[model samples]
Target: MFALSGCAQQASSPGADAPSGEEPAMPDNGDCPVIDSRDWKAWVNAMPGPGAETTLIVEGAVDMPTPGYTFSWEAGMADRSAVPAQRLHLTATAPDGMVTQVITTENVRYEGPAIAKEYRAAAVMCGDELLAEITDVVTAE
Candidate 1:
Protein backbone atom coordinates (compact mmCIF):
# COMPACT_ATOMS: atom_id res chain seq x y z
CA MET A 1 0.00 0.00 0.00
CA PHE A 2 1.20 3.52 -0.80
CA ALA A 3 1.40 6.20 1.83
CA LEU A 4 1.19 10.01 1.49
CA SER A 5 3.61 10.51 4.32
CA GLY A 6 6.72 11.36 2.32
CA CYS A 7 6.94 14.52 0.22
CA ALA A 8 9.21 17.51 -0.34
CA GLN A 9 8.88 21.23 -1.07
CA GLN A 10 10.09 23.07 -4.16
CA ALA A 11 10.32 26.83 -4.71
CA SER A 12 10.83 28.62 -8.00
CA SER A 13 9.67 31.91 -9.44
CA PRO A 14 8.26 32.13 -12.94
CA GLY A 15 10.79 33.95 -15.04
CA ALA A 16 9.67 37.31 -16.43
CA ASP A 17 10.11 35.91 -19.95
CA ALA A 18 8.93 32.38 -19.24
CA PRO A 19 6.64 31.15 -21.97
CA SER A 20 3.34 29.37 -21.48
CA GLY A 21 3.34 25.67 -20.56
CA GLU A 22 6.15 26.23 -18.12
CA GLU A 23 5.53 25.00 -14.55
CA PRO A 24 6.28 27.49 -11.80
CA ALA A 25 7.23 27.10 -8.18
CA MET A 26 3.77 25.99 -7.07
CA PRO A 27 2.42 26.18 -3.55
CA ASP A 28 1.51 22.79 -2.14
CA ASN A 29 -2.14 23.27 -3.15
CA GLY A 30 -4.09 26.21 -4.41
CA ASP A 31 -5.71 27.51 -7.58
CA CYS A 32 -4.85 26.26 -11.01
CA PRO A 33 -3.29 28.83 -13.27
CA VAL A 34 -5.74 31.18 -14.91
CA ILE A 35 -4.79 29.63 -18.26
CA ASP A 36 -5.96 26.25 -16.96
CA SER A 37 -9.60 27.24 -16.71
CA ARG A 38 -10.44 26.11 -20.23
CA ASP A 39 -8.44 22.92 -19.94
CA TRP A 40 -10.00 22.07 -16.58
CA LYS A 41 -13.16 20.90 -18.29
CA ALA A 42 -11.53 17.94 -20.01
CA TRP A 43 -9.89 17.12 -16.71
CA VAL A 44 -13.07 16.86 -14.64
CA ASN A 45 -14.82 14.83 -17.34
CA ALA A 46 -12.22 12.08 -17.25
CA MET A 47 -13.15 11.00 -13.73
CA PRO A 48 -15.12 7.85 -12.97
CA GLY A 49 -18.47 9.47 -12.38
CA PRO A 50 -20.83 11.47 -14.53
CA GLY A 51 -21.29 15.22 -14.07
CA ALA A 52 -17.72 15.69 -12.92
CA GLU A 53 -16.87 18.48 -15.32
CA THR A 54 -16.08 21.39 -13.04
CA THR A 55 -12.90 23.09 -11.95
CA LEU A 56 -12.75 22.54 -8.22
CA ILE A 57 -10.20 24.70 -6.47
CA VAL A 58 -8.23 23.68 -3.39
CA GLU A 59 -5.78 25.76 -1.38
CA GLY A 60 -2.86 24.95 0.91
CA ALA A 61 -0.84 27.20 3.20
CA VAL A 62 2.78 26.27 3.78
CA ASP A 63 4.98 27.00 6.80
CA MET A 64 8.03 25.65 5.07
CA PRO A 65 11.31 27.50 5.87
CA THR A 66 10.63 25.96 9.30
CA PRO A 67 10.04 22.44 10.48
CA GLY A 68 7.45 20.16 8.82
CA TYR A 69 5.39 21.35 5.87
CA THR A 70 1.73 20.67 5.14
CA PHE A 71 -0.84 20.63 2.32
CA SER A 72 -4.63 20.79 2.46
CA TRP A 73 -7.63 20.62 0.13
CA GLU A 74 -11.01 22.20 0.44
CA ALA A 75 -13.64 19.63 1.37
CA GLY A 76 -11.17 16.94 0.40
CA MET A 77 -11.79 13.42 1.64
CA ALA A 78 -8.30 13.01 3.00
CA ASP A 79 -6.27 15.33 5.19
CA ARG A 80 -2.52 15.76 5.15
CA SER A 81 -2.27 12.86 7.57
CA ALA A 82 -4.92 10.56 6.17
CA VAL A 83 -3.26 7.19 5.83
CA PRO A 84 -3.84 5.35 2.60
CA ALA A 85 -5.45 8.47 1.25
CA GLN A 86 -7.90 7.49 -1.45
CA ARG A 87 -9.92 10.08 -3.39
CA LEU A 88 -10.57 13.83 -3.49
CA HIS A 89 -13.75 15.46 -4.80
CA LEU A 90 -13.78 19.06 -5.99
CA THR A 91 -16.55 21.29 -7.35
CA ALA A 92 -16.27 24.03 -9.95
CA THR A 93 -17.76 25.43 -13.15
CA ALA A 94 -17.07 23.98 -16.57
CA PRO A 95 -15.09 25.70 -19.26
CA ASP A 96 -18.29 27.02 -20.81
CA GLY A 97 -19.03 28.89 -17.58
CA MET A 98 -21.66 26.36 -16.57
CA VAL A 99 -21.17 24.66 -13.23
CA THR A 100 -20.59 20.89 -12.99
CA GLN A 101 -19.34 18.25 -10.61
CA VAL A 102 -15.79 16.95 -10.50
CA ILE A 103 -14.37 13.81 -8.89
CA THR A 104 -10.74 12.74 -8.71
CA THR A 105 -9.32 9.32 -7.93
CA GLU A 106 -6.02 8.75 -6.24
CA ASN A 107 -3.68 6.89 -8.53
CA VAL A 108 -0.11 8.03 -7.96
CA ARG A 109 1.20 8.15 -4.39
CA TYR A 110 4.54 9.46 -3.17
CA GLU A 111 6.47 9.78 0.05
CA GLY A 112 10.08 10.64 0.86
CA PRO A 113 12.65 13.40 1.27
CA ALA A 114 12.05 16.89 -0.09
CA ILE A 115 15.43 16.88 -1.77
CA ALA A 116 14.05 14.37 -4.26
CA LYS A 117 11.26 16.80 -5.19
CA GLU A 118 8.77 13.94 -4.90
CA TYR A 119 4.99 14.18 -4.50
CA ARG A 120 1.76 12.54 -5.73
CA ALA A 121 -1.17 13.35 -7.97
CA ALA A 122 -4.02 11.61 -9.81
CA ALA A 123 -5.95 11.48 -13.06
CA VAL A 124 -9.28 13.32 -12.66
CA MET A 125 -12.41 13.13 -14.82
CA CYS A 126 -15.26 15.61 -15.01
CA GLY A 127 -18.46 16.44 -16.88
CA ASP A 128 -22.14 15.58 -16.51
CA GLU A 129 -21.83 12.73 -18.97
CA LEU A 130 -18.15 12.25 -19.75
CA LEU A 131 -15.27 14.35 -21.04
CA ALA A 132 -11.52 13.88 -20.55
CA GLU A 133 -8.81 13.76 -17.93
CA ILE A 134 -5.16 14.69 -17.44
CA THR A 135 -2.50 13.62 -14.99
CA ASP A 136 -1.49 16.28 -12.47
CA VAL A 137 1.46 16.09 -10.09
CA VAL A 138 2.30 18.07 -6.92
CA THR A 139 5.85 18.79 -5.85
CA ALA A 140 7.34 20.96 -3.10
CA GLU A 141 8.64 24.47 -3.53
Candidate 2:
Protein backbone atom coordinates (compact mmCIF):
# COMPACT_ATOMS: atom_id res chain seq x y z
CA MET A 1 0.00 0.00 0.00
CA PHE A 2 1.73 3.08 -1.29
CA ALA A 3 0.56 6.60 -0.55
CA LEU A 4 1.63 10.00 -1.77
CA SER A 5 4.02 11.93 0.34
CA GLY A 6 5.07 15.61 0.31
CA CYS A 7 2.43 16.18 -2.41
CA ALA A 8 -0.94 14.74 -3.39
CA GLN A 9 -1.30 13.30 0.09
CA GLN A 10 -4.95 14.15 0.36
CA ALA A 11 -6.42 12.23 -2.54
CA SER A 12 -6.49 8.49 -2.95
CA SER A 13 -5.64 7.16 -6.36
CA PRO A 14 -7.82 4.64 -8.15
CA GLY A 15 -7.31 1.04 -7.02
CA ALA A 16 -5.23 2.18 -4.09
CA ASP A 17 -4.95 -0.36 -1.30
CA ALA A 18 -4.34 2.11 1.48
CA PRO A 19 -6.15 5.25 2.57
CA SER A 20 -4.74 8.68 2.03
CA GLY A 21 -3.46 10.78 4.94
CA GLU A 22 -2.68 7.62 6.83
CA GLU A 23 0.72 7.52 8.39
CA PRO A 24 3.20 5.00 7.13
CA ALA A 25 4.38 2.40 9.56
CA MET A 26 7.43 3.27 11.54
CA PRO A 27 10.62 1.61 10.40
CA ASP A 28 12.02 -0.79 12.92
CA ASN A 29 15.75 -0.46 12.55
CA GLY A 30 15.22 0.98 9.06
CA ASP A 31 13.04 -1.86 7.87
CA CYS A 32 9.42 -1.71 6.76
CA PRO A 33 6.87 -4.23 5.57
CA VAL A 34 6.41 -2.29 2.37
CA ILE A 35 8.31 0.62 0.91
CA ASP A 36 5.47 3.08 1.25
CA SER A 37 5.50 6.84 1.67
CA ARG A 38 7.84 7.18 4.56
CA ASP A 39 11.40 7.95 5.46
CA TRP A 40 13.32 5.68 3.08
CA LYS A 41 16.79 7.12 3.14
CA ALA A 42 17.79 4.69 5.86
CA TRP A 43 16.22 1.78 4.03
CA VAL A 44 19.22 1.46 1.78
CA ASN A 45 21.34 0.06 4.60
CA ALA A 46 18.72 -2.22 6.01
CA MET A 47 19.35 -5.93 5.67
CA PRO A 48 15.96 -7.23 6.61
CA GLY A 49 16.42 -10.88 5.84
CA PRO A 50 18.86 -13.69 6.36
CA GLY A 51 21.16 -15.39 3.83
CA ALA A 52 23.39 -14.02 1.08
CA GLU A 53 20.44 -13.51 -1.27
CA THR A 54 19.36 -9.99 -2.07
CA THR A 55 15.97 -8.70 -3.14
CA LEU A 56 14.84 -5.49 -4.77
CA ILE A 57 11.42 -4.09 -4.06
CA VAL A 58 9.67 -1.22 -5.76
CA GLU A 59 6.75 0.72 -4.36
CA GLY A 60 4.63 3.04 -6.51
CA ALA A 61 2.23 5.88 -5.92
CA VAL A 62 -0.02 7.55 -8.47
CA ASP A 63 -1.77 10.90 -8.67
CA MET A 64 -4.51 12.02 -11.04
CA PRO A 65 -4.54 15.42 -12.68
CA THR A 66 -7.28 16.97 -14.79
CA PRO A 67 -6.32 15.50 -18.16
CA GLY A 68 -3.24 13.51 -17.32
CA TYR A 69 -1.59 11.51 -14.56
CA THR A 70 1.68 11.14 -12.73
CA PHE A 71 3.45 8.23 -11.07
CA SER A 72 6.24 8.00 -8.54
CA TRP A 73 8.07 5.05 -7.10
CA GLU A 74 11.01 4.09 -4.93
CA ALA A 75 13.39 1.12 -4.95
CA GLY A 76 15.11 -0.60 -2.10
CA MET A 77 17.00 -3.73 -1.25
CA ALA A 78 15.67 -5.09 1.99
CA ASP A 79 18.30 -7.75 2.30
CA ARG A 80 21.99 -8.41 1.89
CA SER A 81 23.74 -5.74 -0.17
CA ALA A 82 26.92 -7.51 -1.11
CA VAL A 83 25.27 -9.63 -3.78
CA PRO A 84 26.96 -10.57 -7.01
CA ALA A 85 25.20 -7.92 -9.05
CA GLN A 86 26.93 -4.60 -9.33
CA ARG A 87 23.91 -2.74 -10.70
CA LEU A 88 20.20 -2.64 -9.96
CA HIS A 89 17.52 -1.95 -12.54
CA LEU A 90 14.12 -0.44 -12.15
CA THR A 91 11.84 -0.80 -15.13
CA ALA A 92 8.49 0.66 -16.05
CA THR A 93 6.28 -0.94 -18.70
CA ALA A 94 2.98 0.14 -20.11
CA PRO A 95 0.12 -2.00 -21.30
CA ASP A 96 1.32 -1.48 -24.88
CA GLY A 97 4.68 -3.01 -23.92
CA MET A 98 6.69 0.17 -23.81
CA VAL A 99 9.56 -0.64 -21.50
CA THR A 100 11.83 1.83 -19.75
CA GLN A 101 14.71 0.66 -17.58
CA VAL A 102 16.69 3.06 -15.46
CA ILE A 103 20.03 1.99 -14.05
CA THR A 104 20.36 4.94 -11.78
CA THR A 105 17.93 5.49 -8.95
CA GLU A 106 16.52 8.85 -10.04
CA ASN A 107 14.44 7.79 -13.04
CA VAL A 108 11.53 6.34 -11.07
CA ARG A 109 8.91 8.86 -12.03
CA TYR A 110 6.63 8.48 -15.07
CA GLU A 111 4.10 11.02 -16.24
CA GLY A 112 1.99 11.53 -19.35
CA PRO A 113 -1.51 12.18 -20.61
CA ALA A 114 -2.14 8.47 -21.07
CA ILE A 115 0.84 6.43 -22.13
CA ALA A 116 -1.32 3.34 -21.97
CA LYS A 117 -4.36 1.87 -20.29
CA GLU A 118 -2.18 0.64 -17.46
CA TYR A 119 1.38 0.67 -16.26
CA ARG A 120 3.51 -1.99 -14.63
CA ALA A 121 6.60 -0.97 -12.76
CA ALA A 122 9.17 -3.51 -11.59
CA ALA A 123 12.44 -3.74 -9.74
CA VAL A 124 14.99 -6.25 -10.92
CA MET A 125 18.02 -7.14 -8.92
CA CYS A 126 21.08 -9.10 -10.06
CA GLY A 127 20.23 -8.61 -13.71
CA ASP A 128 17.84 -11.44 -14.56
CA GLU A 129 16.06 -11.77 -11.23
CA LEU A 130 12.65 -10.09 -11.02
CA LEU A 131 11.76 -8.90 -7.53
CA ALA A 132 8.47 -7.03 -7.41
CA GLU A 133 5.87 -5.10 -9.43
CA ILE A 134 3.18 -2.54 -8.88
CA THR A 135 0.46 -2.12 -11.49
CA ASP A 136 -2.58 0.12 -11.83
CA VAL A 137 -4.85 1.72 -14.40
CA VAL A 138 -4.44 5.34 -15.38
CA THR A 139 -7.57 7.28 -14.49
CA ALA A 140 -6.80 10.69 -15.97
CA GLU A 141 -7.40 11.67 -19.56
Candidate 3:
Protein backbone atom coordinates (compact mmCIF):
# COMPACT_ATOMS: atom_id res chain seq x y z
CA MET A 1 0.00 0.00 0.00
CA PHE A 2 2.80 2.40 -0.70
CA ALA A 3 3.25 4.84 -3.57
CA LEU A 4 6.62 6.04 -4.71
CA SER A 5 8.11 7.43 -7.93
CA GLY A 6 11.38 8.69 -9.36
CA CYS A 7 13.36 9.03 -12.57
CA ALA A 8 16.72 7.40 -13.29
CA GLN A 9 19.21 6.95 -16.07
CA GLN A 10 22.01 4.45 -16.58
CA ALA A 11 25.41 5.67 -15.57
CA SER A 12 27.81 6.66 -18.30
CA SER A 13 31.19 5.07 -18.90
CA PRO A 14 33.75 5.04 -16.12
CA GLY A 15 35.75 8.20 -15.61
CA ALA A 16 39.45 8.61 -16.43
CA ASP A 17 40.42 7.65 -12.87
CA ALA A 18 38.67 4.29 -13.14
CA PRO A 19 40.75 1.26 -14.14
CA SER A 20 40.27 -0.18 -17.59
CA GLY A 21 37.92 -3.19 -18.01
CA GLU A 22 36.09 -2.29 -14.77
CA GLU A 23 32.33 -1.85 -14.95
CA PRO A 24 31.14 1.71 -14.73
CA ALA A 25 29.72 2.63 -11.36
CA MET A 26 26.38 4.32 -10.92
CA PRO A 27 26.66 8.06 -10.84
CA ASP A 28 25.39 10.40 -8.13
CA ASN A 29 22.55 11.58 -10.35
CA GLY A 30 19.91 10.60 -7.78
CA ASP A 31 18.08 8.58 -10.42
CA CYS A 32 16.70 5.05 -9.99
CA PRO A 33 16.04 2.43 -12.63
CA VAL A 34 12.54 1.35 -13.59
CA ILE A 35 12.35 -2.20 -12.28
CA ASP A 36 11.64 -4.85 -14.85
CA SER A 37 8.48 -6.88 -14.25
CA ARG A 38 10.35 -10.13 -14.71
CA ASP A 39 12.26 -9.44 -11.49
CA TRP A 40 9.09 -9.36 -9.38
CA LYS A 41 7.19 -12.25 -7.83
CA ALA A 42 3.70 -12.53 -6.35
CA TRP A 43 2.05 -15.42 -4.54
CA VAL A 44 -0.75 -16.42 -2.23
CA ASN A 45 -0.61 -18.99 0.54
CA ALA A 46 -3.21 -20.52 2.82
CA MET A 47 -2.68 -20.03 6.53
CA PRO A 48 -3.59 -22.24 9.44
CA GLY A 49 -7.02 -21.18 10.71
CA PRO A 50 -10.51 -22.44 11.18
CA GLY A 51 -11.66 -20.59 8.13
CA ALA A 52 -9.92 -20.23 4.79
CA GLU A 53 -7.30 -17.85 5.94
CA THR A 54 -4.84 -16.76 3.29
CA THR A 55 -2.17 -14.22 2.71
CA LEU A 56 -0.83 -12.43 -0.35
CA ILE A 57 2.86 -11.85 -0.61
CA VAL A 58 4.70 -9.70 -3.10
CA GLU A 59 8.47 -9.42 -3.32
CA GLY A 60 10.65 -7.14 -5.40
CA ALA A 61 13.60 -4.77 -5.33
CA VAL A 62 13.93 -1.04 -5.86
CA ASP A 63 16.90 1.15 -6.61
CA MET A 64 17.42 3.78 -3.96
CA PRO A 65 19.58 6.85 -3.69
CA THR A 66 22.12 5.28 -1.32
CA PRO A 67 22.85 2.22 0.72
CA GLY A 68 21.21 3.83 3.73
CA TYR A 69 17.85 4.15 1.96
CA THR A 70 14.93 1.90 2.98
CA PHE A 71 11.80 0.70 1.13
CA SER A 72 8.32 -0.34 2.30
CA TRP A 73 4.71 -0.87 1.29
CA GLU A 74 2.35 2.04 1.54
CA ALA A 75 -0.92 1.52 3.47
CA GLY A 76 -3.76 0.72 1.05
CA MET A 77 -4.59 -1.24 -2.05
CA ALA A 78 -5.64 0.23 -5.36
CA ASP A 79 -9.11 -0.59 -6.69
CA ARG A 80 -8.66 -2.69 -9.78
CA SER A 81 -12.06 -4.37 -9.92
CA ALA A 82 -12.31 -4.00 -13.66
CA VAL A 83 -9.51 -6.46 -14.30
CA PRO A 84 -8.40 -9.73 -12.80
CA ALA A 85 -5.33 -8.10 -11.35
CA GLN A 86 -4.00 -6.40 -8.24
CA ARG A 87 -2.00 -3.21 -7.92
CA LEU A 88 0.38 -2.76 -5.02
CA HIS A 89 2.25 0.36 -4.07
CA LEU A 90 5.69 0.92 -2.57
CA THR A 91 7.78 3.76 -1.18
CA ALA A 92 11.41 4.55 -0.47
CA THR A 93 12.89 6.62 2.32
CA ALA A 94 16.40 8.05 2.51
CA PRO A 95 18.46 7.93 5.69
CA ASP A 96 18.80 10.96 7.92
CA GLY A 97 22.59 11.17 7.91
CA MET A 98 25.09 11.52 5.12
CA VAL A 99 25.08 8.75 2.53
CA THR A 100 27.31 7.55 -0.25
CA GLN A 101 26.75 8.50 -3.90
CA VAL A 102 26.39 4.94 -5.08
CA ILE A 103 22.93 3.68 -6.00
CA THR A 104 21.71 0.91 -3.72
CA THR A 105 19.30 -1.92 -4.25
CA GLU A 106 16.64 -2.32 -1.59
CA ASN A 107 14.57 -5.49 -1.46
CA VAL A 108 10.93 -4.82 -0.66
CA ARG A 109 8.26 -7.26 0.44
CA TYR A 110 4.63 -7.27 1.52
CA GLU A 111 2.41 -9.84 3.21
CA GLY A 112 -1.23 -9.13 3.91
CA PRO A 113 -4.61 -10.77 4.07
CA ALA A 114 -5.62 -12.13 0.72
CA ILE A 115 -8.49 -10.43 -0.98
CA ALA A 116 -11.65 -12.24 -1.98
CA LYS A 117 -10.83 -12.23 -5.66
CA GLU A 118 -7.88 -14.13 -7.00
CA TYR A 119 -5.83 -12.04 -9.36
CA ARG A 120 -3.93 -13.44 -12.31
CA ALA A 121 -1.43 -10.59 -12.24
CA ALA A 122 -0.08 -8.02 -9.83
CA ALA A 123 1.23 -4.59 -10.69
CA VAL A 124 3.75 -2.77 -8.54
CA MET A 125 3.30 0.97 -8.56
CA CYS A 126 5.26 3.97 -7.34
CA GLY A 127 2.78 6.80 -7.22
CA ASP A 128 1.39 6.93 -10.77
CA GLU A 129 4.35 5.11 -12.31
CA LEU A 130 4.34 1.38 -12.99
CA LEU A 131 7.43 -0.25 -11.58
CA ALA A 132 6.64 -3.84 -12.53
CA GLU A 133 3.84 -6.20 -13.41
CA ILE A 134 3.98 -9.79 -12.16
CA THR A 135 1.91 -11.82 -14.56
CA ASP A 136 2.62 -15.28 -13.22
CA VAL A 137 1.08 -15.67 -9.78
CA VAL A 138 1.54 -18.67 -7.53
CA THR A 139 -1.06 -20.12 -5.21
CA ALA A 140 0.01 -22.46 -2.41
CA GLU A 141 -1.75 -24.45 0.22
Candidate 4:
Protein backbone atom coordinates (compact mmCIF):
# COMPACT_ATOMS: atom_id res chain seq x y z
CA MET A 1 0.00 0.00 0.00
CA PHE A 2 1.07 3.61 -0.68
CA ALA A 3 0.72 6.33 1.96
CA LEU A 4 1.27 10.12 1.53
CA SER A 5 2.26 11.09 5.08
CA GLY A 6 4.48 9.50 7.72
CA CYS A 7 1.63 8.88 10.19
CA ALA A 8 -0.51 7.34 7.47
CA GLN A 9 2.34 5.01 6.54
CA GLN A 10 2.77 3.94 10.18
CA ALA A 11 -0.82 2.74 10.14
CA SER A 12 0.11 0.44 7.27
CA SER A 13 2.46 -2.52 7.50
CA PRO A 14 6.20 -2.45 6.75
CA GLY A 15 5.40 -4.32 3.51
CA ALA A 16 4.08 -1.04 1.98
CA ASP A 17 5.80 -0.22 -1.38
CA ALA A 18 6.38 3.49 -0.66
CA PRO A 19 9.93 4.67 -0.21
CA SER A 20 10.94 5.98 3.25
CA GLY A 21 12.90 9.00 4.57
CA GLU A 22 13.06 10.94 1.30
CA GLU A 23 10.72 13.76 0.20
CA PRO A 24 9.84 14.83 -3.35
CA ALA A 25 12.05 17.57 -4.72
CA MET A 26 10.61 20.95 -5.64
CA PRO A 27 11.27 22.99 -8.80
CA ASP A 28 13.66 25.91 -8.66
CA ASN A 29 12.83 29.27 -10.35
CA GLY A 30 16.12 31.14 -10.72
CA ASP A 31 15.26 34.86 -10.63
CA CYS A 32 18.27 36.81 -9.41
CA PRO A 33 21.62 35.55 -8.25
CA VAL A 34 23.85 37.50 -5.87
CA ILE A 35 26.97 39.17 -7.23
CA ASP A 36 30.11 39.48 -5.17
CA SER A 37 31.23 43.04 -4.42
CA ARG A 38 34.73 42.45 -5.75
CA ASP A 39 33.40 41.36 -9.15
CA TRP A 40 31.38 44.57 -9.67
CA LYS A 41 33.82 46.03 -12.18
CA ALA A 42 33.67 42.88 -14.29
CA TRP A 43 29.87 43.06 -14.23
CA VAL A 44 29.81 46.66 -15.41
CA ASN A 45 32.25 45.99 -18.26
CA ALA A 46 30.01 43.25 -19.62
CA MET A 47 26.82 45.34 -19.91
CA PRO A 48 26.86 46.14 -23.63
CA GLY A 49 25.73 43.10 -25.56
CA PRO A 50 27.30 41.72 -28.76
CA GLY A 51 25.12 43.82 -31.10
CA ALA A 52 26.22 47.27 -29.88
CA GLU A 53 27.06 49.43 -32.95
CA THR A 54 28.67 52.48 -31.39
CA THR A 55 30.40 52.10 -28.05
CA LEU A 56 30.78 54.82 -25.42
CA ILE A 57 33.03 54.06 -22.47
CA VAL A 58 33.51 55.99 -19.24
CA GLU A 59 35.60 54.85 -16.29
CA GLY A 60 36.56 56.49 -12.98
CA ALA A 61 36.83 55.83 -9.29
CA VAL A 62 35.42 57.90 -6.40
CA ASP A 63 36.85 58.03 -2.89
CA MET A 64 34.70 58.35 0.21
CA PRO A 65 35.49 60.91 2.88
CA THR A 66 34.50 58.99 5.98
CA PRO A 67 32.09 56.51 7.61
CA GLY A 68 29.97 54.84 4.88
CA TYR A 69 29.73 55.81 1.20
CA THR A 70 31.47 55.37 -2.14
CA PHE A 71 30.72 55.96 -5.85
CA SER A 72 32.41 54.87 -9.10
CA TRP A 73 31.55 55.16 -12.79
CA GLU A 74 32.96 53.99 -16.15
CA ALA A 75 32.20 54.41 -19.88
CA GLY A 76 33.87 53.67 -23.24
CA MET A 77 33.49 54.78 -26.87
CA ALA A 78 34.26 52.25 -29.61
CA ASP A 79 35.00 54.73 -32.35
CA ARG A 80 37.00 57.57 -30.83
CA SER A 81 37.90 59.11 -34.20
CA ALA A 82 34.34 59.51 -35.45
CA VAL A 83 33.33 62.50 -33.34
CA PRO A 84 35.32 65.72 -33.05
CA ALA A 85 34.34 66.19 -29.46
CA GLN A 86 32.48 64.15 -26.81
CA ARG A 87 31.26 65.47 -23.48
CA LEU A 88 30.48 63.52 -20.32
CA HIS A 89 29.29 64.61 -16.92
CA LEU A 90 28.99 62.80 -13.60
CA THR A 91 27.09 64.15 -10.61
CA ALA A 92 26.91 62.63 -7.15
CA THR A 93 25.19 63.56 -3.92
CA ALA A 94 26.32 62.59 -0.47
CA PRO A 95 24.07 61.73 2.46
CA ASP A 96 25.03 65.03 4.15
CA GLY A 97 23.51 67.04 1.26
CA MET A 98 26.80 67.75 -0.48
CA VAL A 99 26.94 67.64 -4.32
CA THR A 100 29.88 66.91 -6.65
CA GLN A 101 30.26 67.04 -10.42
CA VAL A 102 32.93 65.70 -12.80
CA ILE A 103 32.95 66.81 -16.41
CA THR A 104 35.12 65.67 -19.33
CA THR A 105 35.31 66.89 -22.93
CA GLU A 106 37.50 65.23 -25.57
CA ASN A 107 38.88 67.16 -28.54
CA VAL A 108 40.39 65.33 -31.50
CA ARG A 109 43.04 67.23 -33.49
CA TYR A 110 44.70 64.50 -35.58
CA GLU A 111 44.67 60.76 -36.08
CA GLY A 112 47.84 58.68 -36.48
CA PRO A 113 49.28 55.54 -34.92
CA ALA A 114 48.52 57.28 -31.63
CA ILE A 115 45.53 59.47 -30.67
CA ALA A 116 45.70 62.78 -28.77
CA LYS A 117 42.74 64.25 -26.91
CA GLU A 118 42.17 66.88 -24.26
CA TYR A 119 39.71 66.87 -21.38
CA ARG A 120 38.38 70.37 -20.72
CA ALA A 121 38.45 71.72 -17.18
CA ALA A 122 36.14 69.84 -14.79
CA ALA A 123 33.85 71.68 -12.42
CA VAL A 124 32.64 70.68 -8.98
CA MET A 125 29.49 72.61 -8.29
CA CYS A 126 27.43 72.62 -5.13
CA GLY A 127 23.79 73.54 -5.48
CA ASP A 128 23.73 76.43 -8.02
CA GLU A 129 27.23 77.64 -7.18
CA LEU A 130 30.48 76.42 -8.70
CA LEU A 131 32.82 75.18 -5.98
CA ALA A 132 35.97 74.23 -7.94
CA GLU A 133 37.09 73.74 -11.51
CA ILE A 134 40.27 72.12 -12.88
CA THR A 135 41.57 71.17 -16.34
CA ASP A 136 42.91 67.72 -17.16
CA VAL A 137 43.51 65.61 -20.29
CA VAL A 138 43.84 61.91 -21.13
CA THR A 139 44.95 59.96 -24.22
CA ALA A 140 44.42 56.37 -25.22
CA GLU A 141 45.78 54.18 -27.96
> Which candidate comes out best when scored by lDDT?
3
Model 1 misses residue 86 by how many Å? 6.4
Clashing residue pairs in all predictions, respectively, total 22, 0, 7, 9
Candidate closest to the true structure, highest TM-score: 3
Ranking by TM-score: 3, 4, 1, 2
The lDDT, on a scale of 0 to 1, for candidate 2 is 0.29
TM-scores, each model vs. reference: 0.20, 0.19, 0.64, 0.25
TM-score of structure candidate 1 = 0.20
True lDDT of residue 49, candidate 3: 65
In model 2, the clashing pairs are none
Q: How accurate is candidate 1 locally (lDDT)?
A: 0.28
Per-residue alpha-carbon lDDT of candidate 4 for residues 10-115, written as tens digits (9 for 90 to 100) = 4554445457765333222131111111111100122345753333233333332332232322222223543223333333323455434322221111111211
Error of 3 at 127 (Å): 2.3
Q: Which 10-residue span in candidate 2 carries the lowest summed lDDT?
A: 36-45
Is 2 or 3 the stronger prediction by TM-score? 3
Candidate 3 local lDDT, residue 115: 75
Give a tens-digit lDDT track for model 3, residues 93-129.
6678877867667778888777743667878777566
- In angstroms, the error of model 4 at 40 is 17
